[model samples]
Target chain A: MALTLSPTLSLRKAPSISDEEFRKLRDFIYSKCGIFVDDKRKYLFETRFGPRLNALGAKSFSEYFQILTLSPDKDKELASLFEMVTTNETSLYRDTKQLDGVRASILSKIIKEQRAKGKFELSVWSAGCSSGEEPYTLSILLHEELGPELRKWRIAITGVDLSPAMVAKAKAGVYQEYAFKTTPEDIKKKYFTPVVGGLKVTDSVASLTCFQSMNLNDAAATKRIPKSHLVFCRNVIIYFDEAMKKKVVSSFYDNLLPGGVLILGHSETLHKISAAFKPMMLPGAMAYEKI
Target chain B: MSKVRTEDLKPGLIVSEDVKSPDGRVILPKGGRIEAFHPMLLKGLGVTEVEADSGDDEKLLQAAADYTREFFSYANPDSPVLAELFLYATGLVAQRLATGWVPPTLGERMAQNVEHLSDVLPADEADPEKIVRHETELASFPESSLRLKAELESPKASIGSLTKLIGQDLGLSAKLLKLANSPLYNFAEPVESIQRAVTLIGLREVSTLALGMATINYFQGIPPELVDMKSFWRHSISCGIFAKILSQAMGSGMNPERFFIAGLLHDVGRLIMFKKLPYASTEALLYARENFVPIVAAEAALIGYTHTAVSQYLLASWKFPAMLADLINNHHSPKAAPDPRLAAIIHTADAMSNAVEIGAGRLYVLPDFDDESFALMGLPASGLAKVFADYETQAEQTISAFF
Candidate 1:
């Protein structure tokens, strides 16, 4: 039979955002939380906050912007907006190419260097870890790569997030089925076991990591965290403005030991932000090493 | 797992023993299921018996293999790059067959063809240039598109003017917004307004996209007997997506955006032929299918000029960028173009789209391929599989955006 095109696309129309509405929302969000939404990314304001607008039955982006600026529940709405934009609900083995680069180049070099120094301990930090996926993924990789030799090493992976609720979730060590979308079948089977609400990370895997709630913006609080051989603050830096980025990046640089590495999101670059670290381009990924 | 004779074990039965080749290398592992084709492999191994699971779904396996064999009969399965694709397609077909998917019969297809062709007319002109010249300009080409095209060419053009011009046509604005939001650009921020879309997507990109969509909408009413519109657009969109991806994968510092526009309109000449010379176009299609030749060859044989020629003329008349028109014209013969690498990208993209069974009609005919074009990209042959995989999701979303 001749194929009939589906009508799904035309059935739902995305309410267009006016330039004024976009600027208002962008400025408001930036002023409120310092999450600088670039003018080019005006669409993000619509797409991310679209659900909130629908839930409130707001007619237009302007109406939604008005609610955000004027309503008594504005604080609550802003929090929801923040969560929507800053969502890190990523699956296991997210950014496989970058992770592959880390395993092949960065981790191996760091391990060899540490071994040459006769240091058996390795400390890693997942700043804004978001429910522990990033840190736990690192633990899994380190365990898989190290194998039997892992027992002799003192490995510490600290996962920190600003939201206490997310820290609690990370502490629970449970993940739904969706969490393993990118995870290999053998890895999923070996590292996770079926539990009540979801699959629980195996004890051995869970033992390598810990979760805590600490705001990245707090200078003293960030410094209190241990100095690490590698710092992973991916996808979290997009929420900050230029000044905030420089500040947070400086904090990350200080948090890393000499010759330690820092990794950001694939699209995120230190271009025009800071020039302190030396950038290393790996196959399909990049890492910054502290001088 | 229990011991069973090789003859007794059917497809879908799990193998309990490691079936090995004459060289003693393991071919199938203990947990591997026996496929319909495995019997031949086992016989070649000179093994008469093997251990396997008890139950088997022989009928379902045979049905799947039969469906896949017929579907891909035209493609050369021996090609190293396409071997994985054929296997992937077979597995997918097998899953669908298990889910109660049934192949449509010849009579059903014919009936649908008659319905589609009911409105089709006879050929008007034989010469390609004359056909294009005699054909009137697109009556429905939006005034906004022409204005936007002029603006895009000007050095002093502002994003505000472009946005206002695009905003004049709600359909154009939505298309731009969807394209911007779609995984094509994959921008970190959402594209909400026409202004933002212009600033983010760029003036040339936005203009070419608008022209492409407008042209598609103009030819929407083409008789399905000539070419199913939805399938045609799907093929075109997929080719465009593949071209963009190929350019990116090449990492040769070529502009992928131009490749996308070129690929999207590569088959546009055929659309003209279908509209202006319906019966003749069908003759070419049937000739291609019956003779097992690429459609371009069939069109060239029957009509004396291929669709690319018609497409080039039509695009040039419509004021499309010269480079895009040239790319479309030389897609079937890439090495001859001024920028061979750029033309090679489109050529490879077109073939890849056809190899994966995305086409302008129900009949899937593999396009004539040139290994030199692929070689020009400098990408590993292994990357082809990943390219095909990426094309599926991106094409799916991009096509839906247009509709």
Candidate 2:
């Protein structure tokens, strides 16, 4: 019997990235931003950037690279590149254990110390706040903590992201139902007003927060921001190389007030990153206190 | 107005005042009836007591049932399958309430299911090859079955020539005749000859059956102790039969035999998992058994991917049609597939096969029936009972014929 194969039986084709082009693009991206793309991540780059190449009408990765580096609109292209590489997988009140720690220990301690010192100001910086959920969440926590006495204090909740698009989204403060996956229903109801596409952060919550576009890799730009009482830079530094991580951590240290708190993502640790801050074990989370 | 301990709060007792956590967050609102799992949830958040409103026990029980129904109503309100599943789930919840059994919340249940999975596939050891082998060892169809399949696929093939070809294998011919005479066909007279059986059952169906039988016979060498081979074949055949029945019922223009083949090989990856990684496979089984989670989730937790992905890999490696590969790949979550109608049929059929307790002797949990898929099919709830009844009636004969 003659063997006849089906004419339609072909493997799904994905655009391939060559080795030389991958090296050039990876190095270019790493120099501009701290994101390190190793050899194993060649497929990741290929699959993610293939559509971008097609969209820009560029034929090859090397051509896309030249366009990104040499074009007058290079900054805009780089911003788009950052948007693709950075994952914005965040939600309101993410990491409940960490939030619990913030509420029960960190916030409570801060409130008591402020009242004792007769200080009436509190500032929190949500660094790398992709799409603004973290800052809004912090604002809500502050509102809950201060309650009727909120009028007595000056609060500043600033959210910053490297991506302009994310910063704009954070400023808009509207999110789909997916953003509330981990959020308590009551919290959502209290802080958000129902909108056509999704939920809009209530004016009260929206008023308490501000959004800014800033790159963490740019030390000069980062230093311009005021030192904050609490800095949240969770899940951001994981994308950076070891040296970049150390630089960012030290900058965070410089950007925090004395006796301030810095919270990292749950999986992150400061063991090899920095020794400037002392680790404080809260109930269900960990915080680094600037002693 | 009395304060009740979180653990002592019974279902249907409404809170008169807000139950707040240590952080002053309202854990449960006033007028909220304590659910079966609420006590644990409250306790987990460090709530000790809630002020209960004055209410009768009968009123509370009624309130609890209403709450259970309301909870399930959030799942596709338009889907009758969802409605039926809701009714079933609510009944179970009511029974548990009566027995004073506090069911775990979905998150708790998932956490329990995946507690050990994290250890198996740690963050650092996420090697794709270790989790899922790229080079799968799937046996090809035997020469006779291949020729039979080719002949069946040929446009000019006739019942006479197909009957003659099938008659060459006396075992296959006899099985076909027996299946034709079985209750599945409901023939008044016995199908004594291969020609008449082939004519009655049609050339495509007979060939499909022969292919199915040949494949099952080929895989019969798998250790019976590792898997109950009879029950496995029964489940596969049952799924295939259900898929065919559902497609016909749904008025889908796709060939019923294609669905049959898709369903038959949907969990073939599980067999590969069992054969290749017996230890991990057994661990997945044990996790499912202990946690009351589906075997697929357990497999994904223990290994990175589920049997569905493995099956897709095997099918693709075997040079099967893309549609077949795609259907099996997305069978578990049919709504995600491009050809959702086909995937939904197989998904529903697979779930029904498991729900009716004709499953391969592994996990006893029912796969979640996708509401969107069910709603998309627009299958009347009235016809569902009849479809299931028809499947049940035909399943035994079909299983016996294939086995």
Candidate 3:
């Protein structure tokens, strides 16, 4: 019997980004948001934006670039684009060593300084706080430390991210199980209530934090943030080039109070970017202090 | 001591063995009393059965029989082959329980390997379409294989007609005959005639074999420089053999042929990646070697998706059965699978295949066995000795027949 053949399944090739288009988009993103996409990350851009092109009905990367720049709704498109390009990989108590350092050294020292100065208020900033884990973790740590004494002192934790979607999620304060991977069971039980699909941060923890959509590249907007006693800008600077890193680090420097601590991701460093902050080696982690 | 299905297990029953969770952490130590929450917790962790201390040998044997009956109560196998499989599995389970056997702990290095991968590749990037596009450059069922599948799917299709149709393709026919004569069947004499081969191996089995052979032929041109094709096939074929044996031992009532094909094709996505994205695949392999992690984790870090996810995408796109797609997708994490037993079989088979060192050069780190999956299989450490012995007895004949 002559076989009736079905059409062979055609292979769907991924859309490739050309050198010129890659450079154009890379430069535009860097200029607009301080995100540096090098030649090696060309594939990352292609994978992320390829589907966006299809969604927007753009024929090529150059056309997508045009839409991003020239469209009247460029602000909204750029915000959405920021959501795609930024890596929001974070969880509660993500780095145990750093968190331990905060609990043992940084928090203790800061509380001592505040008490000596007769200051009854404290402020913390969690830059690029994707979905609010860092700020919430800080709040939880403070709650644990203060216990009943928390009612006497006013604490403010401001979480800022470039992605409005993430800021919204942070405001909602609900997180899936992945967020609790590193969280101790006792802490989770004490601070969170079981909700559908995940745990919801209690009103107490939620009230301690305030979420805002602010781009780090927006100097005017960043200047408006209150000077914090501690600033966490972990894992956010790796995407920026050396120049952009310096710009962001300088902004962080200005945003922190004197003797305030700055914590970066474990692998990230301010070695070549900034000499203003002195690196402090803590028990299990490294932090930078503005003297 | 006797094995009891998890559903039949009541509170106060003594756990005879240390029950571990899917991630290999011990949840219940040996001689612990089952509490109200213990069974629920175990069920949540995908445990379906546990051995209980029955006090006496006779009582233990009775409990084992009762448990085995309860285990197979949902299965109403009409075929003699399936009935024999149930008997073999029940006997094995009882024998192990009688001896108070325990499974060996997985290698510490293997257990730690997947953590490194998970660290690099967070679970959020498992996009199905992107996975398919990135891995599969060009994949399709061969013309002859398609026709064979169509005929098999038809309700009125006969073995005689399938034989004739398959015979038209000399390569497929010869492959089927060789498989039939191989130690997988344990036939006394070599099966030279295609009709007899089809008769000896059921129509479904033959059709599955033909499709697998056609697939191997279709992708025969994947560059050797990108992958050691010989080692890849050796690992694949060993996994197939192991899966078939495991399915029979578990009394899963699934077609062993389907299990064989699923095992053979479980890593098809990895092969496609090697062919289409050679540079990236090489980087992933190198990363795995350098970091002492599994290749799947390296692939996830480098490419943002593991081969298992890619395999699921390809299988779903090709209109394979949803069960098959889900089985492949959760093979690496069997406790997450909706059908944990089937996933456990494949997962264990994959690990055992790697453990035998059939294709050691290509695989850097052996995949860890899911402790919950091992528990669900109800086999003991001694069972591994028997499986290895069986594989040694059949390995040469089977490899020659398939390769």
Candidate 4:
């Protein structure tokens, strides 16, 4: 048979990130910003940055990654990059299973133990408080748990974030209805008052919490945070590299009382991080107890 | 006395001890009798559970034991090797039932009320080798997997070449790197590069894992009617997790990943049977369920050979690693392997996965546990709790990573 071949088009439509490009970019991002983008989320890089690459007229993901590393405008681009990934969808009752576990097994147990020692004080540090939903939710839980006896105890719930803007919004104590996606209607009616644009957190819950801007990487700043009986750092450590995770976990360990607990994200574990905290399995979640 | 959630509370439960609110107020005193309204009252105060005598533990355990016995009708649960497994399985069933886990019921048969399934699913004289030969598509392995297999067999293969080969296949590269970072390995840092992943998760181990993933991905067109793909892979991944954990517990110097690979592909022959001989396979499945016999026994009775024999021929024709081939071939009869102890680890792992009901792979009847192989290991049944938990977590991660 005579040679017969069909022609093909070799035009590039959209830039796709090769495996090597993904690895290189993630490594650079982790080293510079402590945000480790693992392989499971590799597709996220392309989806997030594809439009940016087209805007910049970059040829491929490798080219875009090169511009990010070598171009003089890298710092400006990095700012936008961080801004894109950090608009979190934190809600009133995120991870309800873990919250349920805390309410069921942990809170009362701690209260009973504290009463045994004749202490009427409770402290919780909401590391990476992220616009205040977490600390406010926690305050709601504490208020609901303690009921009318709340005034008898000295309660301090400190909420901190790396961004000052987020801290400012958190301190505003205002949220739209979208924030109550998982919140029960009764809880919303009870704990929140309707405002002009949204519902503002009632003062009872707001009074128990204080928000400020603080960097976790800054050890000195972390040290200034009050010692806590419980540290809520869910879904925050995934952004950090190994060294940063160790530093932040060690800081949590140092800031917790002897019998305090540390709760990470529902899926996060302290494996190969430290042996100082003993893992206590609750109903559907795990809490790390300071040894 | 048992811990009852506030939502599940009933009247007439007597409190075992004082139930206190979060503020140190005693909600219910010791020996206090509970009424219907107490559950809601306690829930309002955030009391999630109370220790009360429900007087149903014995009845629940008895029901669970009966369920377990019916579940293992195909296996000799009273055998020396299986008695402890059966007891532990009963406890797990009871625990799950207490937590409102409903057992899956085989609702209705498609070919309703057939007195003899053979009338519907005609018999076939399907030789194992003939079945293997008929499936021509599986013979053409994925290109990346083929190259990796060859590189593994070659003495001159270097890590650089291996990395380059894997990097070319984006799916495999992503899977391998993700697996390296998964809790199964618990690497100290994020594994971002293929080279680092290979180095960290051993050169041979990573290559073998990639091979396994590629092999699994190649069979995408298998009809859903033949099997539920997620359920099948869940069974495979759970078996692999169990094998790896069991190997670690044994402290044997062998590479645990090899056991994982063997367990993962141990059911490859069944997949081939389903693809090549759907009618006979359906007959075997129905026969096993109706007669309360293992699928292997049903296959051997109906088709002259089990899926294990089919797997042996397929792997041999593909020139797979000799040890892996032998492990898959003799999994059903581990006593015949050269290193019966190693083969027995996979055997016991398979049994444990089935006992825990991770996924049935549409094999409703439990497989026969090799008593001789299990007796060779000298492991306590108590240790299996940790193994089962570890397998569950890792299997979930692996499934999510691939699918």
Docking level for model 1: incorrect
Residue lDDT tens for model 1, A1-291: 111112321112235577788778777766655566655344434544556788899989888887887999987676666665455455567667678889999999889988898898899999998888888899999999899999989999999986666778898889887667567789889898999988888888888898887767778888988999999987677667779889899999999999999998644567678899998877656788999
DockQ numbers for every candidate? 0.00, 0.02, 0.02, 0.00
C-alpha positional error of residue A257 in candidate 4 after TM-score superposition, expressed in Å: 93
Once fitted onto the true fold, the runs of candidate 3 whose alpha carbons sit more than 4 angstroms away are A1-14, B1-403
How far residue A254's Cα lies from its native spot in candidate 4, in Å, is 91
Error of 3 at B318 (Å): 50
Which structure among the candidates has the greatest lDDT?
Answer: 4
Instruction: Give per-model TM-scores.
Output: 0.47, 0.46, 0.46, 0.50
Report how far residue A180 has shifted in candidate 2, in Å. Answer: 0.7
Q: What is the lDDT for B25 in model 2?
A: 95
A122, model 2: CA deviation in Å? Answer: 0.7
**CAPRI accuracy category, model 3:** incorrect
* Candidate 1 residue runs with Cα over 4 Å from true position: A1-291, B1-79, B84-88, B98-124, B137-142, B221-226, B358-362
Per-residue lDDT for A53-138 in model 3, tens only? 89888888888888899999788889889888774455677667668877799998888888888886899999999889999999
Model 1 gets an lDDT of 0.70
lDDT of 3 by residue, B1-403 (tens): 7786675554556789988787888888998877656766888998877877745534544544443332222112222222333333433444455456432222221222111111211112225465465544455657786777676566777788888888899988888788888887789877888778778777767777777677678778876655668888888888888888777765656678777777777788786566555544655665454434457755755555677766766776666555556666777888988978788877877766764541121225444345566667776644654565576677778888877
Docking class of 2: incorrect
Question: Model-by-model lDDT, in order?
Answer: 0.70, 0.69, 0.69, 0.73
What TM-score does the A-chain of candidate 4 achieve?
0.77
Candidate with better lDDT, 1 vs 4: 4
Candidate 4 lDDT over B91-126, as tens digits, reads 566656665566645322222222111111112224
Query: Cα miss at B281, model 1 (Å)?
Result: 1.6
lDDT of 3: 0.69
